[model samples]
Target: MPDHPVPDPGRSLEGPLAPVTEEITAFDLPVTGTLPAELHGRYLRNGPNPLGLDDPVQHWFVGPGMVHGVRLRDGRAEWYRNRWVRSRQVAEALGERWAGGPVHAGMDFAANTHVIAHGGRTLATVEAGALPYELTDELETVGPCDFGGTLPGGYAAHTKLDRQTGDLHAVAYFWGWDHLQHVVVGPDGRVSSTTDVPVADGPMVHDFALTERYVVLLDLPVTFSMAAATAGSSLPYGWNPAHPARVGLLPREGTAREVRWSEVDPCWVFHTLNAYDDGDRVVVDLCRYGGSYDLSALSGQGPLTLDRWTVDPAAGRVGRQCLDDRPQELPRTDDRVVSRPHRYGYSVVTGEAGPATVRVDGSFADDAFTDALLKQDLATGRVEVHRFGRDAVVGEAVFAPSAPDAAEDDGYVLAFVHDPDRGATDLVVLAAQDFPGGPVARVHLPARVPLGFHGSWVPDR
Candidate 1:
């Protein structure tokens, strides 16, 4: 490990972006505009929230996980709640033991990064930690889930749900394990299969893609390093040029041995919007980075642009093209169109140097931050943007379907925006179809919600 000085925790865990100190529940949140009566659900987001004030390791992604959520019902802002995922590391740090019961061997739960509701349960998940922790609609931790002791490894933070099949698919990798496993959770919330895909090193597989017939696996060059791990580095993964950059097309119902690998230029993808099958090729849209791993600068030193990759299975090749050149991340689309072709997508526009900016090139300019939300019409190549100006920063925008059978883009784009001037956060709701217009409603919160990763909307049943 290269010799380096101690990092300042204030950079990642202080001020308007600071982590909440404790768990709290607030009732009847204040709203600025009228919330849609059809918008009834919880907008829950999860991210790293360090418990220790003087934490020795201060990497942005190294802290314990905390979730901030808001409840909406009958056009009224119901309540707000924030809670830690209660992993073993979090339990010990808080001087508490795991009251839930004995944990499974080799399970390390952080339950951060992303949260999703499926099969009648909400799972709080991280990429390489313990199994997902079950949470109630109110944000209470029920306990860890191993699919009833069937999951062989940790669950990936981003799992693709098949709308056609009602199945949950994930590509998971462990820190010390040489092979990654492709896990399938059935509609009944049980682990159906665990197929081990052998590889020489443990690469960080943050997210994957799914089409009508296959699961797309990204085996990039960011590999785990034992030197950095033992040297007290907060993030131990580094770029290995020797490792081949490739995309694996695995049959949805087959084992790992049936996967077909195709070579592509070296890159990293932290998240994907949507993917679909097109005759003999599979097209996937995602935010692509050029370099290896850097925890201090999660986006790395490359241009973080929205790109589309076309994978030709027979040719054993992958082609890429930039959809929009503006710097952006956290691309999302309507979940109802996931695993198939969709016409609309949404992303957060990152600016030069601001509070919520994930500097892709490791250089932070004075005024750089994510300043706007972007809406793209994939069918017509039309782009619309919603800017927040200079004093505010925006998080990922999740689309909530307007009705059970509404059109693909007929819904609201919900996100948390932190205003440094006001020193508070607001849940901004924008009409998905009216991207040129401003927010339909701004649900004000009692506290400032620190910038975090992915989130999901669970509509009231």
Candidate 2:
């Protein structure tokens, strides 16, 4: 796994190989055959951007919201952290939260710096770095203990920080979803190194997990993105993410051994399940299968139910042994959604659906969409979908770490919401005791965030 230098976009697209706009439509969004923009103002928007939750955070998972790198007094904003804003120098790069994006695209707006917390206290707020987030808790941008490698940048496709080893892990890819880039960051912000691995055939590595010993990934291979940029094409095609999907397991150390990839179709590669280690075996709940479908045809379609798969970390053995023949489905409105592995075996995601069909072009072709507070039982493979009845679109959700002596009633989930239809997006809170139902609260966001890629609760550990 060698790094294939990402060629300059202008140099790659010229002559006949240039990407045609028509061809790019396929690579922009996944899950085709829905509907078109005819539903704009009615469902989408045609006005002069009436909603002013401007430059809000896009796709993400949640950590408690903090102010000035400190936990804030208000609940309206939990830090929904991800790679929406990075230091990439590419122009065509599309920002938003898709696993892959336009050559040079992004926003300078940041809601709250993505921070790691201990209960209600702030430990670190790392800006997007090539390796894990920078340890901006109390240091300069450079020098010792700094993540200095250059990541894909532009709202990086995906990232994961291993809880076991405290090694920050991020995923980077050039194109064709065939290659894998793993960046590890130490607690001091010092980067280990970057390594290339095999990925399923798609444009993005939809989701990934980092453990004390291994790095697991679900690669949605649409690898031609780099080739398209090099050729100066807006839309890069001629790639197949489904020839056979793969789940990979790699050693966490350097040039790890037993790196393996297997064919498996995960439904929501981006908005997916989490991986947990049970000692004797490692368990991962995979939301199988995704694509870059046309939005014009696939509007009005609901969310696709996802199958849960459990994998063996040592042997790379995979099986859909947990879910039913049909998986549980979350609401498919336009709100962003995210999930984290639960303590026992179940997983919880805070999300909501909207009436709008305008989703950001995430890292993969169909990388971006919306969701609700979804409660899933991995063992029996049952799902509970929580819809936004009050017209609220739940954004990122995380199971706040529970203290050893913490009361059960004190246990809760933290989240954010983006509701453009009502012209509002807010930070929110839900009690896990009553999750998928029960009591909920909303905090008005200081601004609107579209959607983001990967994030974590970083419980008060």
Candidate 3:
């Protein structure tokens, strides 16, 4: 570790993206507007909060994991809490022992990308082959979970839960491995199956899409680089033009050899909106970057837009057409309709128009902050935008249905929005059908929540 453990003065560390210092707990939060009487459960989001950076240069994506959770029940905001996932280094930094069990591939870093509840447990997850850390309902770190010792390898930051089968599916890639591993955890909280799909370069697979008959893999251009690793970069991956960009459709119940590879243009995808089987073809909607991981700039270059890829196995090609050219990321749809045809989708419009640049003192420019949320009606090609005022930052918007049999748009969209005016964060709830009509309720918090990755609305069953 470095002597001071301070972040290098070349990354974004100010404003809403700034990291918080300590854990906090607040209760009986004040709320504005009417709270839904039927809404019950916790809204949790995970993101990087660097305890200390030992590396010479730190990427914004590689910080230690911290989870912020707000509990709502019976039309009232009950509590809000934040806790760091207790990896060995994080525990030691806090003067506590590591709470997790044995790790795979010697990678026990913080699981700081997203959090979800499945099979009666809460798990904080990350990417690039880190095991998931289990947390209690109240946000206490329980330790790393390998599914009762049944998990064969590392876990992924993004896992898709099949509403029809009650199974969770993930695709994981390790730097040392030559192939990507597809893992399935059954509804019973155990690993049911594993399959290895070989590839050329060790591409950075941030997220994958799951459909009814296939697990979609994005083998893009960004890949592992030894030079970046030796250059003291915490995230040792960069854009590789030589590595061909392609998408793979692996049979849901078949081996790697059954995967049909379809060629697409060179691009990078960090998240997928959703995927579904359209006849014999597969349709996937995702946020696509023109390129990613500019090693010199240490940021992504080019505009990001929502694009749809139609994989035609009969033609051995993947066709892409831009649905919306607006710059955005972190797309989400109704989780229940994941891997199936549906209508409504939502995303946060990142204001960054080009490659993001950081200041010499590690501060980001004003354009780096996300300022609005948008709702897209795929059925009618309608889009609604909700601006959270200037300098306000918004995280991912997760949809929770009003009922088990609720209509596709009959739900609430929940997100954490930082209000520069109040200098605090709020859990803003908007009616899915009436989006852009202002939040129905804003549960104010005691502190600010930095802009983060994906999260889930864990409804009480």
lDDT of each residue in 133-192, candidate 3, tens digit only:
999999898999998899988989999999999999999999999999999999988999
Q: Candidate 1's residue-wise lDDT over 150-260, tens digit each?
A: 776677788988877888998888886778888989998888887878877788888989998888999988888788889977667878788998988888764335888
lDDT of each: 0.79, 0.37, 0.84
Locate the minimum summed-lDDT window of 10 residues in model 2.
41-50
TM-scores, all candidates, are: 0.92, 0.56, 0.94
Best by the lDDT measure:
3
Backbone clashes for every candidate come to 9, 83, 0
lDDT of 1: 0.79
Model 1 clash pairs?
108-130, 300-360, 301-361, 352-368, 353-367, 353-368, 353-369, 354-368, 354-369
Best by TM-score: 3
**Candidate 2 lDDT, tens digit per residue, 1-461?**
11112222221222211111100001111111221111111001000110112123121222111221112222212222112222222112332232222231232222223333222222223222222223232211211112333334422324455544555566655443355667665665545666766544444443466445567766543334445557754234334535455666677655436676655653334434555555635556544334443222222233433454566655656776535223222212111111224432222232123222333221212312334566555444555555555444454454442343454334445444555554534444455556667445554433344432223343222
Clashes of 3: 0
lDDT of 3 at 304: 73
Clashes of 1: 9
